[model samples]
Target: MIRGEWQNPALTRCDSKLAFRSLNQAAIQAERASSRTGELIIAYTCFDCGAFHIGHADLSQQLAHTVSVEPGCRECNLPIPEAKKRRARACSAKAIYCSDRCQKVAERKRRAQRQMASVTPQ
Candidate 1:
């Protein structure tokens, strides 16, 4: 890409990895614009505008202000591993268990408990 190519406003340019100076500048700009105190973790350099854009590292696609959960496996009550946790968060439908074995065990327990209750007088 030539130097003049960078000048085009409508160019579909790729994101350039921001340098420390660029990130610092973006941080300062963000801080000045907002009264809230927060550090910028993600930075991207715009090739067309030659400007640095600052943002948070929320690759999970969750809402900006929402609290992210480190959810436990429902069936075993064990903490979900990092990769699985991310997958659960990313999934459109909620995840119920860490594995099929735990899910089957829980289902069997529920069925047995229901049978026992039904067999009793009360």
Candidate 2:
């Protein structure tokens, strides 16, 4: 990836991590784009809360969901967490989490109300 030195795919294959990263990003963009066309929609975290919401990634960030169970990317259709970066090897094939930031954002939002309530004067 640093330089065009890979003259052989077998002898000098590209890093799997980097390959997976680029592929994943492209997939996300494509998924978002498709959602805008009203043909595809990815259930992304509200960023305000961890609740499941369905809306076009490009058009608007509206809240919409039919099921309590969170779904993964439509393209891969794999069970994934809200956000994750590192992919575990021995955990399970159906791992999910696009990045750690997403996971944290979701977690924070999810616990925000609870934490606020605990600190509020009752």
Candidate 3:
């Protein structure tokens, strides 16, 4: 049996829904439900109850709402490509620099500025 808590105890048993404490648990339950019912189930956070819930997965609608905007490199302002963005996302990075050379150049400039500021006469 799936483990979850009722959203409200006072309300009618049918009126309240079961809420999962964590996204991971909800996702596991959703997967089981999908296989048992032959439907695409999804796990999502409930805005009103602040808990996870299982619902129907709508891939087409989700794909339509996704934005394609990619940010430029922080140091040289060069545009980042889709491939690089995907790689950065997989590695859990922000992808600030377009390349390692640009990152090194930016670090060197920052180091020089710090040294110059420290050496300035009072």
Candidate 4:
């Protein structure tokens, strides 16, 4: 199934391939393409434009080397799953937190700390 909408060739560098500005957008298209085509589709970052693109998961071997060591969440120190690790590799972004709740808590703590620092008298 066709995954994404067509764009000007100048923008994508190719008339056939579709480019997504974010991993989340590419991932959503990948899911739809996977479901329709019955293939393991995945979102990957393009080396040329740094935009995300969709392709077969098996093609990942040509992209980049997978991380050997498992990483833990920064906020809770919990181990991240292998699936998440794969997704992180595709996007070139590390998974800092295991869940959204942990990320939110970390953000709140940072905000509070900033507020406290700003309000304190010298």
Candidate 5:
């Protein structure tokens, strides 16, 4: 989740959404985690206004947490194709994604029935 969007766990993780430095940090972290294969970092950018939001998610299982990540695109806070990852990179400075597929597919489901999507800060 982006800054101010997180409330649970005291929201220890929150960073800028459109900072270049942030994007680089995310790329490096993802590169190391995925063995250089590259991880998904979804970035939210507005089409009409070009405004964006950075989403935070962990692809590596090593960094496991008790928190539950509901299925959906981390950026834009909307449900999209699994192949369409968020534009945001993941890093202390900013955010990024492993692949376009992983980023986009987030929160996306193939099931006929769908569950309501919400980003509740518990």
Candidate 6:
């Protein structure tokens, strides 16, 4: 979650569609109760828990704030394939995987290497 004054423990987690619907409903109620009705919200997946969270910021703006870096597959050391570049752009600044498959393969390899290292200690 982006750190700010808006962090709340009560924020419910939901999928993108449901979250937008709920945000709309809440915004409607808030608008009805208040004089302003320009309330805008966006849903983003929380990096901490892998859950969706809603925030009062534009998606493009939030994405713009992210500093994109050249990414490579940790397991293969291959520069992100051309096909995956677009997908990589949408990922978080710290994203490690060019794709889900790469992530899983890297994780499995890491675990195996760790086990081998542990069994062959100097």
lDDT of 5: 0.43
Ranked candidates, highest lDDT first: 4, 3, 1, 6, 2, 5
Q: Please give, for residues 1-122, the per-residue lDDT of candidate 1 as tens digits.
A: 55643455334342443333576787676555444645334455655566677655465532564577766788778865666656768976566777768878989999999999889684
- RMSD in Å for all candidates: 11.1, 23.8, 14.0, 18.8, 23.5, 18.9
Tens-place lDDT per residue, model 6, 47-68, is 5544444556668765865688
Q: Write the per-residue lDDT of candidate 3 for residues 1-122, one digit (tens) a residue.
A: 97898556434432466689899999999889988998778888876667788887788845764688667888888987667777889999877888888889999999999999889687
Query: Candidate 6, which ten residues in sequence have the lowest lDDT sum?
Result: 12-21
List ranges where model 6 is wrong by over 4 Å.
1-69, 77-93, 120-122
Model 1 misses residue 84 by how many Å?
7.3
TM-score preference between candidates 1 and 3, better one = 3
Summarize candidate 5's per-residue lDDT along 16-82 as a digit string, tens digits: 3343245455455545655544444444333433444344445653355246765554445545544
Model 3 misplaced stretches (Cα beyond 4 Å): 1-68
Instruction: Give lDDT tens digits, candidate 2, residues 1-122.
Output: 49765464532322221221344454575477676685555544433332334434443433333346667743345566533323454455543545555556667877997898789575
Candidate 1, position 22, lDDT: 76
C-alpha lDDT of residue 49 in model 1: 60
For model 5, state the Cα shift of residue 12 in Å: 5.2
State which candidate, 2 or 6, has the greater lDDT: 6
Evaluation by TM-score, superior candidate among 3 and 5 = 3
